[model samples]
Target: MFKKPIQKYTGKIGEVEIGTGEKAVKLGGESVLPFYSFDGNTGNTPKIGMEISDVYPEGWTNTLKELYKDVSNDTVKWAQFVEKKYSPDFICLRLVSADPNGKDSSPEDCAEKVKAVVEAIKTPLLVAGTGNHEKDAKLFEKIAQAAEGHNVLLMSAVEDNYKTVAAAGVLAYNNKVVAESSVDINLAKQINILINQLGIGNENVVDNVGCSAGGYGYEYVISTLDRVKLAALTQNDKTLQIPIISPVSSETWKSKESVEPEEEAPEWGNQEDRGISMEVAAAAGVLASGSNAIILRHPKSVEVMRSFISELLG
Candidate 1:
């Protein structure tokens, strides 16, 4: 009988700590590919973060609306609900109100909301700005200041708008920053390098490879993630070895297969199940591709993915 060969690598993913004292959560520090414990050490199991929005999720699907209906009107209450009910590893606060096209809320207001949520949650928090680059720079600066010393993860400093967020990470607080790049490994590396150049240590950086839902170029994201991980471990690429985070909920729920009702696509079967499955599939793909943390929505999806991670790590 032939024995399977075990592969070892020269580099390990850097570990990042969020929160402080007893509430802290440590992610990354894995020495091998996801779930490849037979080959090398899998230093930490992936962590799940539940998403909460600064503004009411008015445009969310009915299912999502129902899930948070009781607390939808209040961001602090919503964060508390997720922490108490689901016990997620962290709470991700999406500052949708800061969107330039949307409420365009003032930086001070957004910062106050961030501070309130930070004070309300015991688990670590991940704060994200609305997708407006120019506005996010100002938004994150205020948020980073409000969340100082709390050790939150402030996402993200992209290729074009890194200086502002990176400076906030260094000057405002010791929080980590997410470096996002379109689905290209080299671009991902470049952004990480640029973020580090701003004096943010590699350990304080997380990579986001521009996530895509299952049917919408998800495979491309997965392949890019795989290549990045390969570069980190196989070739010992320091610039590529930081932890990766996937905003699975945001990507999956936006897909037509997830949000479209069964009435629109009868062949898709139950709409609720379809949406949950879509999230689970996307999350599992990212986890297997070496993501250390995932931002998720839907309690059912969180439950299912938690079980899946347990099985993989076991």
Candidate 2:
């Protein structure tokens, strides 16, 4: 007798909701691999976030600079502009000014800007700080306090400062935190364990297993994502079962192939097209590999990723 084999899983990525009211977005909750609807469930259709920074966005290519030219000077305006024009699944604000090595902007001031951005839009917001552990810990605490009732998503809580970030973001206030680790599966599982030990449930925790642009040592990123998702779906590892969000824009934009000038890299073709292609390709690669959500920079890249997701969902 020929019987179609249907695979069943004992574990599922927990679903966590960000923001409140009508526009709140949910990620995670897949009991199967990426788009493996035939086997079990592919859970949500994944998510795409438009990335905006607190700074003036200098050194950006002309297309992006012009897109937000009027709003580039103000973070609030930048948030509003993207929301009005594109309406991404969510808006992720990069608190670059808070880097101790950079402008070293005060946490208080950054929180004020965050509050204003929250007030200006109905869509949910994800607040991220400079990658420095010490600096980001302080920045996450302040922003978490400012966006308390809104229940926004904080960029991350690394091993160095998970206590500070998880305490303030999840305990003191009603928000979620990203357990970010370098591209290591063991580290990813360990960090999630440490965070859960803080008394935070899986529903309030997401994982950032790390990622890179497609050709730039990206094999590491893809492999880590695969291991984590497979463990969650097939092996049912609770610690690694949380949703994973990859910041594709942050990794792709800085690559030479995406940003080098036409005069310098004429063989590569148009710069904007080149960048968008890079962003879309990198994003598609991660999504296929098992990322629950992604962060994209250029609006065109966001549009392309969204269309690809739509086509896949259909």
Candidate 3:
């Protein structure tokens, strides 16, 4: 008889609950590599958060745009549509309109939009800002205040700028913050520690150690995330023990494999199908490497990944 090798982990990813009432979602707390229930507790299945922007998506391919044509004009309507149509585990509202170089939308405007979305949808919300550090700080403060008591997952608090957003999300609003870092594991750990030092418990923090799509440095992301998970499970590193969030949709769509049209490259097959495949491939990689929650864009990609997750868990 042959013996099966079994491994044990000292640390487990912590669980953090978002939203309130029946539609609430819980992420993380997995004791094994995503769906590996035979070795340890799976805790909860990973959650998929559909990404919807506060502003109409600009520069999105026509295929991506058409998917939300009905509600693209309005942020609240878009959130409601995704929840009603797909019933995603959560909804991520990216406040792109707040970008200083873009719409430069006021904090009050962003706050109002956040409030409207929360009221319009039953799903838990993950609110994110444009990648502008200073602008995000201001945006998060208002978003946190507007979403007070809602327990939305605030998108980020980075190494260069975390105080304002961390305070807004953790201290002021009692919400959670996503501690983001580049592909560097040390930077990822450092940011988490910095956020925790601000009195935000590790339980209230999730890590986003950067995400890359297929054919776009995807392997680097996978390895970095795997390292983080290893440190958490094997070394019992507290700073890296929090659940991870990968915004795969954003990176996937940016890849040439996703955006290049068939006319541009006939060998790529249908652009839409290629894009979906790219997103699915990137998402699968992220999940396998230990992502507790993922933000996805296309509806078809979401459906496919959901089914894939079902099969994996089963």
Ranking by lDDT: 2, 3, 1
Residue pairs in clash, model 3: none
lDDT of each: 0.88, 0.89, 0.89
Residue-wise lDDT of candidate 3 within 42-70, one digit each (tens)? 87888999999988897777898999999
For candidate 2, write residues 209-263 as lDDT tens digits.
9988876469999998899888888898989889889988888888888889899
- Best-performing candidate as measured by lDDT: 2
Best of the two (2, 3) by lDDT? 2
* Count of backbone clashes, every candidate in sequence: 0, 0, 0
Q: In candidate 1, what are the lDDT values of residues 275-301, reduced to their tens digit?
A: 888889999999999899999898999
Clashing pairs in 1: none
What is the RMSD, in Å, between candidate 1 and the native fold over all Cα? 1.2
